[model samples]
Target chain A: MAYSNEVRDSFSKELDGIREAGLFKEERWIKSPQAADIEVEFPAGAEGKKVINFCANNYLGLSNHPDVVEAARIGLGTRGYGLSSVRFICGTQDIHGHLEHRLTEFLGTEDTLLFPSCMDANAGVFEAILGDQDIMIADRLVHASIVDGMRLCKAMRDTYKHSNMEHLEEKLQDHQDKRIRLIITDGVFSMDGDLAKLDEIVALAEKYDAMVFVDDSHASGFIGKTGRGTHEHCGVLSQIDIITTTLGKALGGASGGCVSGRKELVELCRQRARPYLFSNTVAPVIVSGAIKVLDLVSATTERRDKLEWNTKFWRDGLVKMGLDIKAGDSPIVPVMLYNAKLAQDMARDLYEEGIYVVGFFFPVVAKGQARIRTQLSAAHDQHHLEKGLEAFAKVADKYGILGKSKKEIKEMYGL
Target chain B: MEEYKKAILEYVIKEYLEDDEDEEITYDTELISGGIVDSFSMVSLKRFLENKYDIQIPDADASPEAFDSVDKIAALVVRFKQA
Candidate 1:
């Protein structure tokens, strides 16, 4: 056989080692649509259990919105399902241009270019814009996709302390001899739910002649007062040089992303970005739904307001219960458990209580920072949240982790 | 300064390599390239040194090369302390 027994045994042993290390991830089957309440089946062949989902990135709860679904259906009928060619070829449709225009206006950017996903956008953007002479100084806690993108480019990669403007300034000063300096960060950190200090970053960037790049995947649909993005939230909407975001989360929960920023930069990506140049164009259904998503979010702030209220309510509840949670304003609340096994056990118990959550441990986060990352959504009503809080309280009580701080938990669990 | 090295080594072992009880870490042990300390841990380690020494180490001097070992980290802290 082409695949030898030795190689197969080695792979099996590796899998066994991962399981032994309590790091093997098993996927739960979701029979229902992505929403607040989902029917999940664990252990492969078991019966599905209905649970309230608290682990999805569905911030605005537009994933199964009826209107957006109808818009996608209309698009399917009018434009068909897939585009077999790349954008430069025959895949460029009128709807694609229309969606890009709408996104540009919605994000308050000069121009926009669509990509297959935000991962692809990050992967292709750096190599297209920067060369060996340039330097990319990123926040240490930037998303993994940005790291991959930085690796693909020839620019020298450096990092500053997370959200430390002084560190960022020092790095910028050190890189002044380079041709260009780009400061990259996430608008809202996904794990900690903390908002980036864009105002401070922009000030330092201006002082040092460095450009700013923000990946607003977690903050795009419902962050600012008017729900534009973190740039608008930080009062620097037009000042950002590059902003990349996804349509897969709060914006219709479909698969598409874009790089929006200065016209010249976007034009460069359109011409030279490998993902956009070589990969197939985004499907018409996703584009049509994303257009409707922009329309919905732009027309009113009802869903965004609901999401903000939900986040506040959930956070306040968790705090009142004395659970050790990350302090932040975004909806991604991480309840610290410190020990990886304890986090996993607590998540399993929470699942048993009909509240769906996942344990995040080392590799996903830092060592000794294991947590249950609960994401609130606009779809969750007061009743759902109350029940979810009750489930959490019960599970925390069972784990004897209520009111325990991080240090205390570590001392207790031996992290 | 020797105390600083000992404290740094203790913190690294307690925080980053706690699960590996058998792993031996000295002042000259590789922390970054050996994968014992990742970027995230390095941030916290920097913060720990800053808080412990009450000194500001500029990001230019906080590179992984400067933090690859307990001795290097102690030297960086002492430099900031005397500055």
Candidate 2:
């Protein structure tokens, strides 16, 4: 047992290969709380206190919000820490009920059911609702969870071209006579930051007697008046049948998900969903914190507005830098670098300069579509945004990505 | 009938696998843990088995002991035919 041979040696060998290729994920231990500015403890700071953290999913500047933290603590005191049972089996708390009901009202749905995560919320939905006789049509670039869900279901599945309504209509027409047809898509595409054309999807649903489902993981808690989701963004909130979202992304970055939809569908999912019936319920503190988040979203318009302003400002700045930032209003801005090595190298250079961002290429996106996915946060002030952009420009110029000098760049654009 | 079973096994191999060289499977060979058909793909292949043989692979008939390998799958089919 002491002699390393098969499994352990194989693991080390594989990891060494990854290390050689510069692909090993070196997870930094974050020391400080998730705040506007963060601190990470690394081995390099042996003699001195050195810290850095620029990559985080806490977009709305609320990870360290006093009120949200207090709400979580209060709920922990009032209702224990975790239930440790499924929602249907002695795990349903009053706060969970209140959150579900409030979310239903907030999203203009008749009912809602919480899940372990938004991934599960999307994953468990298909097999619960659709069966052998049903058909599921989805956008080509919908999230992985939706694709996995369809795989579990015995539905006739077809993927339309990404955000291409014409191709979606073609698939819908082909499946017009199916017993049930469900059209699914992501509201704000996570990779390119482009939005789904929900208005056309809604019209197609109506024309073909099909229902619509949207995994609004990226769109919820922002992107519209009152921050409903893609449906709200497209002014087709009433047409979408099933609207599922996560608490982890925008709703205070907690650990849960919920599906807001018609009363029958929501109740049916509660009864039949695998995770809801088998897995443990979310902790009471997380739910209570999520409730506070919903309240914050409803009461003040500050968070989402700030996020919108940041997105536009950053997108415009990156485009001006001549790095070919994908055109979109969503906060998931992909600054295109085209080659995998170039994208990864750029990410490394940016990290060294104290700006944390991640490079995504194949198989996350298509080959030759490599990009540095710079996620914007409401926590980032104008100064931080400007400094980050300037750092990006300086590094990008240093890497010779801008093709010529900044004077030539400005002159070419006539700025 | 045995020939039909062989053909069905070969067909399952051809359909599930990516390469024809990978399709050199005996009727008695194991396919599940051999990593040919996954759980989700098993559902579709089960549909094909039922349709091709005109036999419903019942829930009780779909246990690991009977459907775990292609040999076991064939044995289960023969047992069903006798019943």
Candidate 3:
């Protein structure tokens, strides 16, 4: 059953616009677990044929790690499967406590608490500490989950332009008397893969009498020395007031999120965060597995170092190819193709050549900044990075992007 | 007012353009919709307006309207400064 025919048709019209705009996303059925090279197939009913996988959040190559897989199995054997209850009500397990403590220690924070996803880690935060009297000034480019969380609170919400500490201070200038003035930003912006200038933000926070909040989902498992997050990368881990991160990326390539910060904030989220109180507990196997993942991260920097090397190789190669890649040093390499159609065409071509990456255009990034976002991981070898770079260069040259780069296009457009 | 006007225009062009080539682009040329400025530079422009010029912009003003062209951005800057 569906809505009335008129209403149904009305929604379809907008969806058709999405298709026309080339933003209509369709998922391909994956025939294998996520990895550097994925195999995906369309069912018999669909129009497209089988394709290799390229887009996944698994940055550490651990989604299918034998050791991680074994840990999941062992946890299941010892702890059983799902917990039907939420954390407050019969959902908390001994492993949950252990994992939280490990994350806290690893992050060099006072405490930590888990969420079903990084999205909820953000969703739970604003309402937990912010109230009608509080004020939050966020970076304009923070993730959607943070926006949703802000909506749930009554605090006065403001946005500073991405990474602009001066603008953040200007926004904070008027709120000098609020009960709380907090600055929130994504530690590493997910789309462009640029890092938030935490040192500057911390200075602004101190000058303006505000607390700091950062979501380290994209940066947590790979950027810093010990893979701690932007805090470590910024070398200001102790100055920030709050840090939220994900286990879904470089950690274990499974789903879980957490907030690590002052013991009070962690305790506050545990008791007052709606999702934590209402959502079902994460599967026991996932928690236990994540505990082991944290331990592995604590033990070595091999994977993290590989990730940095791989990122430099890819970023530098794309630049040498005369492509317009964003300048941020983070692992996210956006090969800019301003035209949406060109971005899509490039992505389609890359898929055909067995390279997996996604094209991001308007609404995700600003219009006319359309790009192919290439995420590099420890899982990628030198050969993999070189192959991806070579494939990108070939496709870019074929599209007239090599000799006539995004720079030339900007020159013509006066932008 | 005159210096603010010049600096704002220069900043907009510098943020929009890759190589700081010309200074005569019209004030009303579209920045976002005309594809002169994308998300990254739009952000840079916002910071320029806020910090260098002391103008306050709401999140909603991030659209093409305020940043559409030199004139529109100048107008936005003036209105924000006056306010």
Q: Which candidate tops DockQ?
A: 3
lDDT of 1: 0.90
How would you encode candidate 1's per-residue C-alpha lDDT over A1-415 as one tens digit per residue? 6679998999999999999988898989999999999999997999999999999999999999999999999999999999899999999899999999999998999999999999999999999999999989888778999988988999877777678777778778878998999999999999889999999999999999999999999999899998889999999989999999999999988898999999999999999999999999999999989999999999999999999999999999999998988898898999989788999999999999999999998888866678999999999999999999999999899878788877678778977
Tell me the tens digit of each residue's lDDT in model 3 across A120-208. Answer: 98899889987889888888779878888887887877666677666677778967878999999999998878999998888888888
Candidate 1 is scored at a TM of: 0.88
Question: At residue A209, what lDDT does model 1 achieve?
Answer: 95
Error of 1 at A134 (Å): 0.9
Candidate 3 residue spans exceeding 4 A from truth: A42-54, A410-415, B1-83
Report residue A368 deviation for candidate 2 (angstroms).
0.9
What ranges in model 2 sit over 4 Å off? A1-4, A7-23, A42-54, A403-415, B1-83
Using alpha carbons, what is the TM-score of model 2? 0.79
lDDT string for model 2 (A1-415, tens) is 5656787888899999987865667666666777556655444553322223335566676766788899999999999998878888799999999999888877878899999898888878888888888888777678888877787777777656567777677777877778999998999999988999899889888988999999988888887877888889898976788988988877888789988897888888888888777889999999989999888888987998998998889888887887777788888888777667777888878766767777886657754567789888788888778878888898888867674533443344321
Please list all clashing residue pairs in model 1, or write none if there are none.
none
Model 3 compared with the native: what TM-score?
A: 0.83
Ranking, TM-score, top scorer first: 1, 3, 2
Please report the candidate that would top lDDT against the real structure.
1
Question: For every candidate, what is the interface RMSD in angstroms?
Answer: 7.7, 8.1, 7.3
Where does the lowest 10-residue lDDT sum fall in candidate 1 chain B?
B14-23
Better of 2 and 3 by DockQ: 3
Model 3 chain A: ten consecutive residues of lowest lDDT: A44-53
